[model samples]
Target: MSLRKQLNDILPTLLPNNPAEAIKGTELIRLARINLTGNYSDASLRYHFSIMSCDPTSAIAKVEKGQGYYRRSEPLPALSGAQELLAWTQGRLDDISGDDSSVDSAMLRIRKFRAVVTRYYEVNGRFPFAFRDPFTNTSPLGNLWKYPELVLVDWETGGSPDEEMSLDGGMLSLKQRLGIAPFRLHSARLRLSPSLMTYREDFFQTLSVSMWAQGGELIYAGPIADEALADGLRKLSAAYGVGVTSFGMTPEVLDDLPRPANILNAHPKETEAIMAKLDIHKIAAAQSRPHLDWVALNSLRSESEEADKLVAWLNHCIDERRAEPFKDE
Candidate 1:
């Protein structure tokens, strides 16, 4: 069967409302242009179809349609069109939702959707109607980031910081020195958490690993000038059982850290005075170590029946963590 027919049949089961109608309309338009006129480009067809998946009556949807025209008119307009469409979608969603709490939830969904579309454009040099499972003919929020290993990090803090140390200065400095773009840096209080008060260094190590698993890099930024704190960070890195790199508290080395430009435009920096004492390292090494390998534990659960129940329990905790609202500091 033609892909359009398959989609037409499947979409009703999945959407069954205005969204379905929009998708069907998009498919019909695409098929007619292709089968009869043979003038429609795949990129143009997919772009229109994806936009139609949004509410056709929405102002953002209108902008999306305009973007399609722009994309068809020229080669370089695809990225601009996609970017504008995303911004409009986000703005429209915010305007309608009018709920502060749902902002992160909504952004998360949009980012995931953006990531997929951006990747497709990057590879194919055009927008695509590539509706993968969760995003199929539905809003991006239908499925957000999910990893079954996030729950291992304890969220409760024993108390507030004795003195709030703003790491913005250090983070900006690190970004300048490293020449990396801005990325989310977890606040010191959030990073140190139950570990500092509990005096359980292992907890701090676990927290580092958890963040690494969720994001990719672990950055601890704080007053490393203190020798004791510096030593503690080294120990944390060692305990983390990952590849470790330490700049100590020396401003010279810290300032000398390699600056790599990236699209994220921000690097994760550990910046809590109390929590900043740990050596930061790439967490990729953990995958080889079974005890600390959350991914391996989860993926291999079926193969290793003996650990299936334990893995399932661990995954359940991770799911609970994943469901929690995103905390951006």
Candidate 2:
């Protein structure tokens, strides 16, 4: 049987009294483009499902890969401090330099740097630039350039810092120095209850992996539950089905995470954060207007009224033109 159908059959048995909860959660997962499935716990009788949407090559991956590691398994080269900022700046330098040798050597250097940054904070109990505000280019909360020597090195001459460069002279240099690349790495944290927090992280990661695996672009991430997760997933599923049957999901990954919240919601949230994050506005609209063909037919009446008004205006203009006549020579 189809996964959706199987889910439908199992849902009643899982949550006899709370089928609505299952529906609500499932719907939200679909909308959020997260993938998950779960089994009922005999002890609690509460279907404990996880949200799975984080991508393997997500921002977390970038941080890890930059430091020659994986996920949260190992120490990163930078850990949200001045040293991290330096490393980030240096990464841009390497990108700009286009130094093949440096690129090859960067993984080791990044790992070492991540370790150093962690230790720097261990002794000092503070990060290098906790709030440098990279987007605004202002250190409103923290000064990243605590080390002047590092700053000098960052802003030094615009040449191939370590040669091995080629790509229209200074173009490659400028690109790296300015941190202008096709791929950018970023990370942020959100607040949520322990239960909700776990779900959110799982959902984010699952979505990330699916998107990357399918060569899709990322949008954003956040916690969702109650009616929100339900509504989102339903809309998403309607637009795109679930599991390995879907373009970007694997059965193993899908079965490992949270069940859809839609099955549980009697009335899902009209406004869900996942919809906004994924830019699934169109999908949401379509779901909301399931009878969109009827809407178009109704809208045609308004168009007809407008057309009548235009016809009257055009006739009036023609009459005026006739009255005025051609006075030009």
- CA lDDT, every prediction? 0.29, 0.25
Per-residue lDDT tens digits of candidate 2, residues 1-329?
A: 43334433343333322212233344433422222244433322212222111222111111101111112112112211222222232233322344556433433332232232222222232211111223122322222211110000011122444431212334435654774421111111111111211323323322332221211111111112223333444444455332111111112222332223321121323213212222111111111111113243234335344323322432342333211111112
Using TM-score, give the best candidate's number: 1
lDDT of 1 by residue, 68-172 (tens): 211110011011011111122212332334555544433333333233222322232221121123222233431222111112222221132632212234444
lDDT against true structure, model 1: 0.29
Off by over 4 Å in 1: 1-217, 243-329
Sequence-dependent TM-score of model 2: 0.16
Each candidate's clash count? 13, 61
